[model samples]
Target: MAIDRATAALLGGALGDALGMPTQLLTPEEIDRTYGFVDRFVAPSDDHPVSRGLPAGAITDDTEQTLLLGRVLLESGAVFDHRRWVDALVSWEREVKARGSYDLLGPSTKRALDAINAGASPEDAGRGGDTNGAAMRIAPVGIVMPFEPLEALVAKVAETCSATHNTPIAIATASAVAAAVSCGVAGGNWREAVDCAEHAALRGANLGDGSARADVARLIRDARDLVRGRPEAEAIPLIVERIGTGVAAAESVPAAFAVLELAAGDPWRAAVVGANLGGDTDTIGAIAAGMAGACAGMASLPAGRIAELKGLDVEAVRLLAAELVAARFDRPDGRVAA
Candidate 1:
């Protein structure tokens, strides 16, 4: 049987994160030179201090922050508690800092959290930022809020994103990702899912300066036109070049969507293609992987690749995901009951 929606999100996010870890910083050419198209998970290099040359299966901030969001949501039950969300983020930062590790906190997130600690309102902490940090952590919200009305879900995502990515583009991008994942779970087609995300993003974009929105919108249009009847290899670079893969929400989110559009039914291939594209590989992999995982379910990911993800609370994530699905579907005793 296919994995449940929640388990699919957890495993999808974690596996994508772990797969992209080794190739995170390498340029596409360097990746080509070193690994010649990364088809399987590989160990980190000896020079890399993070994993100490550990074999494949090492997850990064993508999965870590995703789990943090899951934990917060599960604990908060059905309510969208802003203070609890802020507290959870701050508490996680403190705990990570105490351990002398900055593993889970993105640069933008760290800056926003620091500003929050230094007296900026949590709502204002990410005022000018526009990074993929918020988008990377958005999968759980999609899982939790799948059945809600689209506007309600978008509003909650914006609220969640405000803590560390309040810029219009960042908020829009994060909401789009969450909305796409949620739509996928609801059995939307690839085109329908992308359209739902585009709609959510356009709504957020309209509320701000709108330049980033225009850019992503144009890229999505162009990507759709370009990928018709083309192989993923022919289409990936065109979209990435036109849309970009930088950590900016505008750049990364659309590139992910393009890859998803091109590789609609194959989550593993889509993620691998995104990861090897270089330039924000992890974020690309995370975004694309989340969508594909939701659409295709966890079984779509290869058994070998799933075996390679490292350093995550796998069982906990699975349990939380199952609980979230249960809650959404009105099961007798999901995590909300406990």
Candidate 2:
């Protein structure tokens, strides 16, 4: 039997995160030189900024923040109070700082936290960078809000993201990814979920923090067109050169979607494409592979790879998925889920 979509999505993201961890910041040239192809989960060979010295199969901030969002939703009964999220993140960062961890947090998060510490309101703290930090770990938002109307979902997304990535592109890209996950969890096919996501992206791109430079709508359009029928090898280089795979939501999110489209929703394949793309490998892999896993169903990932993922068992993820689904259905407008 297939694993539940929720379990699959979380585990798939964790798998991609671990697979791409070692190669996170390496140049495509360096990735080729160092590991050729990252086939299994491994720790960073060199100090790769965000995740140095992490054990093999250890997750990065991508999944950590994703879980944090989930925790907030569950604890708060599905009500999205931004201040609660702010407090939770402050505590999370405090712990991260206490651990003396490296490569664990992004620049945008660091800056936002600093501003908040300096007394900036939570609403205004996250207006600096427009990176994919918000998108990388936003799956939980989708999991919890799958049934909310699109406008409502988008509003929640805006609230969730504005704390650290209050830009149009970032929120839209993150919403698209989350919407895709929601559609998948609801039994939409990969194409169906992508379609849902594209629509959300269109609506989201129309609004923003007014400082973004990249036209996310155009980038996604070109990205989808560029790899519509291309193979992975051909798509990887082209995407790297044209679409890029860095911290920008416009770049990484679209790149992940293109890889998913090209790979036909194979979680592992999509992840490999993103991981091999060079920059922001972990985030790319996390988003693309997680979406692919959800849309393609749990069995879409390889059994071998699933077995190799550590610290994130399928059963545990499945249990959480059940809780989230129940919580989603349990909630009423502006009320906590049962």
Candidate 3:
């Protein structure tokens, strides 16, 4: 049977997260010295800051939080329930801490959740956040929403991201990723998907708190243009030096687009490149590979690796994808495409 676009997207992001797990925060040189081009899954380095002691093919907070958010989305349907979301995060964090993994929430999300715990409103809690935490785990939003008539999709992205990353840059960048995934799920080609992402970025910029330092749409365009048709030797350095692969939305999101462009929408290739990209590798891989998966579908990835995913419920992920697709088309406004 052919794999569905939604399933492909969710699995692809997880695979990318696992592939990049061992190399998440290492510099390129250190990655080369330790693991020598991490094209496959490997155990994290012993002294690794966040994911130390994890075995090969193990996922991090990226996939875990994604699945958690997905469950929340399923429960609430179209309307976002901030209370449910907060409860879910708190529970997930507690579980993660119990597991003794240092790979907890990212800075922006941690701070926002802390503020919320301290009695701040959800709307105000994330006002200062401007990182890629929103974008990294936003695939479910794209999976359950349509990209066309872009405003609706952008609105959904904003609503979901508001509690953890309410700043303009965070929302705008995440909207771009969500738009690409939605366009790709609709069977659009990579070029069309990226174009939709650009428009979504522009639309999302005005929805969140605080001003963005740079034009996210233009940055994505520039990132794509920088890597298009370039040789790997030349392109990788350019991406690392100019575009960057960091925790900031302005950096990692655009870098992910550039990596997607470089891989020509190949989910496996995109994930590999993202894993080897140095700083914030897992997030870059998750975002880029999620877009690639939506365009290419799950069959494009390795079956053995997918089967090797131990703790994660692969079946549940696929079922969630199908459910999200159903809910997407059943929206009251009839905004979804047939």
Candidate 4:
């Protein structure tokens, strides 16, 4: 049976994460010299900074955290549970250490969790977080919620980001990704999803610390326009240089949207191009491919590639998707089935 949008979103993020694992953190020239084109899964280079020693098709913290958030949501229902969320992060980090993976927690997440562990209030823990960590793992929030009444969705996004990324820029960027995923789960087309994302970013910017400099809505619009009719060869470099492919939420989130637009919502193509986009490649790929998969469904992904994904629980993803769909219907406004 074909998987649903929620499953596609989670799985696609993992697929993109794995696809970009080897190429992440390298310069574009380094990527070209090392892998030429990252059209298939490959083991991380021996000297890779973050993903070394991982086998081909192994996912990184991006997908692992996405699923972790999904599980938290499942256990807590639609309501936000800050304590459970923090505990899960702490436990997950311990488990990752036990496995001896260097991928550990992201900088923003680590700092916030550390503060929380030091007895800082949850509200204050993430106040300084400004990275793309929240956006990178936001797919599940989009999956479990509906896109309509976008303010509500943005509120949920804010709640999700509060534990590790409460800054305005972070919330805005994550809200954009979540809105796009929610739109896709609602069966909206790519254009509609992008539109929703922009609007959500605008709304999200109004929350959190309002003084942050970045304008995520305008950034996403510019990123999309920058690559409108350009070929992949031209657009990819343009995005890497102009919008950037860094760990900053302002950069990676917009870069992901730009890749989605450039690929015209082709999930596999989005994964491929995102993987080759250099710095923070896995995150950009995860966000872009998650959006593409949300709109196009699992059938849009290559079957062989899907089968090759390592350490991901396909059955668990499907079950979460089903439960999320049920939760959406449980909402008062839910009408059509997802």
Candidate 5:
């Protein structure tokens, strides 16, 4: 049986998040010294008390936040429901606080959610945030609304992102990611997906000098050119530096795309290449992995990488994926189409 698109996206994202958790901070050299290339997901570092060396398969805030947003979307069934989004954020904050999880909430998300709880307008809540939280949890939107009109999908992404990231660049990056994922789900070729993403991003925010969109686009083109005949090990470093692995959407998004483009046939390698890039590895890996996973499906993912996601809520990911597929492809007849 063919795996549904939504499940494919969710599982892909979760697996990437889990696999990159342990190597989130280490640079290529540090990762090599500490974990040595990280082919298989392993437990977190013993030095980090909070994570307490979380087992190999443990996921981080990336997956958790994405899943939470997916639930909100599934529950609401309407695009851009502010009340539902507020409730979801509140509930997520409470859950994380109750669990004593420190890193589960992004700074921008926390600030915006706090502002919303304090009676700030949703439009104003995220004005101070210029972070990538909006981009990180946006994959589900792509999965659910893949075939919707571009204007509608872009509007939904803007509405959702405005709660924690209203900056022009942030909005652009988020829209680009959602559009790219949607293109992938729609079975467009990689070049087509990238083109859609570029157009969507340009519509949302101009690609100014030093902007994330410009940087990511440059990286994508360069990586594609460099990887034509080079081995992954040689090409990955160049891509990472050009694109970066920082929290900025420009850095992370492009880096993720580079991994996907370079490792087109291997989802596992794509994710690891993202993780080993050092800063913000988990988010980068998560974003890249989501796209790669959607394009390649579960079968293309390595057994070792899938095995590493052991403790993650796989069933939840699967359920979210199924729901997104239903929302995107399934009509009343119970069949999926483009």
Candidate 6:
């Protein structure tokens, strides 16, 4: 039997995280000098900030935060409890510190936490955030809300996004990623999935409580276009050239889509190319890998990388899949057509 969407998506993301951890902040030149086109997961350097001294296959904050959202999804069932979920993130960071791990929290999230500590409400805590953190863990939201009406999906996704990174672009970006995952689970082809994602993102852009540039949607569209018809080897520099791989939702989210387009929905290649993309690799890799894996299922994922995954909650993901499948809200019967 094939690996289910949940398992494939989560494990695929973990593979990307492990593969990218060693080169998290380095330039392509630095990465090439240290490992020469890394084909395998390697241990992080002690000088590394977040993942130092970890085992070869250890995952980082990307996978860990994904798991945190997975747990929140399981605990809350189909409801999007904004307060509980954000609180759990703060708690998760504390746990990371308690364990003596140095996996850094992103700027938007750290600011939100500081806001909360300063007596701001969770709902108010992330009003100013505009980073990729909101999009990073949003796969769980899409998993449970599969098949919902497009408007409703976008609205709910934006509401969830409000817990952190609440700018219009941030909300739209997360919705796009989640929308793609939902489309993939419904068995849509890659182009169809991407098209659906753009629609959801556009719809989501109007629903958030935060401020954002009016041109963000156009920027994302431009970034997404860079991957179409381009050779995989040429796509990365072009992506870095224009799309960027920074922490801002606009930069990182579009970079993720470029990977998806480059891979043509191949989970393994998406992960590999994402790892080599040279900035914000793990999150971008996870975003693309999750969408690709959801569409391809476990059987189509690269066997070698899946075998190399370590420290992932494989059993938990399997269990979560059963619940998400049962809770699926909506999908047209002809979902493959987008």
Off by over 4 Å in 4: 1-3, 102-104, 333-338
Better model by lDDT, 5 or 6?
6
lDDT per prediction? 0.72, 0.78, 0.86, 0.86, 0.70, 0.75
TM-score, every prediction: 0.88, 0.92, 0.96, 0.96, 0.87, 0.91
lDDT of 3: 0.86
Winner on TM-score between 5 and 6 is: 6
Q: lDDT tens string, model 5, 197-265?
A: 766776666422223334334544655675556677887787666656777676677677777777763
Candidate 1 vs candidate 2: which has greater lDDT?
Answer: 2
Number of clashes recorded per candidate: 4, 1, 0, 0, 4, 2
lDDT of 1 by residue, 1-338 (tens): 11365577667767667777777766777777766788678776666434345467677778878888877777776556668888888898887777555754677898988998899888777776788898898988777665346666777677677778777787778878887777777776556777777777766665432244444555566666766678867776776677777777777777777777777646777778777877777778877878878777766767677765667666777788776666555532212323
**Can you list the residue pairs that collide in candidate 5?**
6-321, 7-321, 57-308, 212-250
For candidate 3, write residues 1-338 as lDDT tens digits: 11399888889999888999889888888899999988888898889898788889998888988888877887875577778998898777778779997355788988887888789888898888998999999988888887766778888888888888988899899999999988888888778899999999998888888755569999999999999999766888899999988899999999999999999999989999999889999999999998999988867888998887646899999898887787677865523333
Give per-residue CA lDDT, model 6, range 16-61, as digits (tens). 7778888777766677777677667887777876767788877878
- Clashing pairs for model 2 are 50-103
Candidate 5, residue 69: how far the Cα is off, in Å: 1.2
lDDT of 2 by residue, 1-338 (tens): 12378777887788788788878877889888877877677667755666666777777778778878877777765457778888988898888888677346877887898899899998788776588988888887777776347876666677788789887888888888888888888787778888878777777765557666555556767888899987777878888899888888888999988888887888887777777888898899999889888777777778777777655656666777777777766656523463
Give the lowest summed-lDDT range of ten residues in model 3. Answer: 329-338
- Tens digits of per-residue lDDT, candidate 4, 1-338, equal 12387788888888899999899989889998988888999998899887888889989899999988877876776577888999999898888888887354678998987798799988889887889999999987787778787777888889888978998899999999999999999898788999999999999898886486577889999999999999999999999899999898989999999999999998889999999999999999999999989988978888799889888877887887777777667766532222
Q: Of the candidates numbered 4 and 6, which has the greater lDDT value?
A: 4
- In terms of lDDT, which candidate is stronger, 4 or 5? 4
TM-score of 4: 0.96
Of 3 and 5, which scores higher on lDDT?
3
Candidates sorted on lDDT, descending: 4, 3, 2, 6, 1, 5
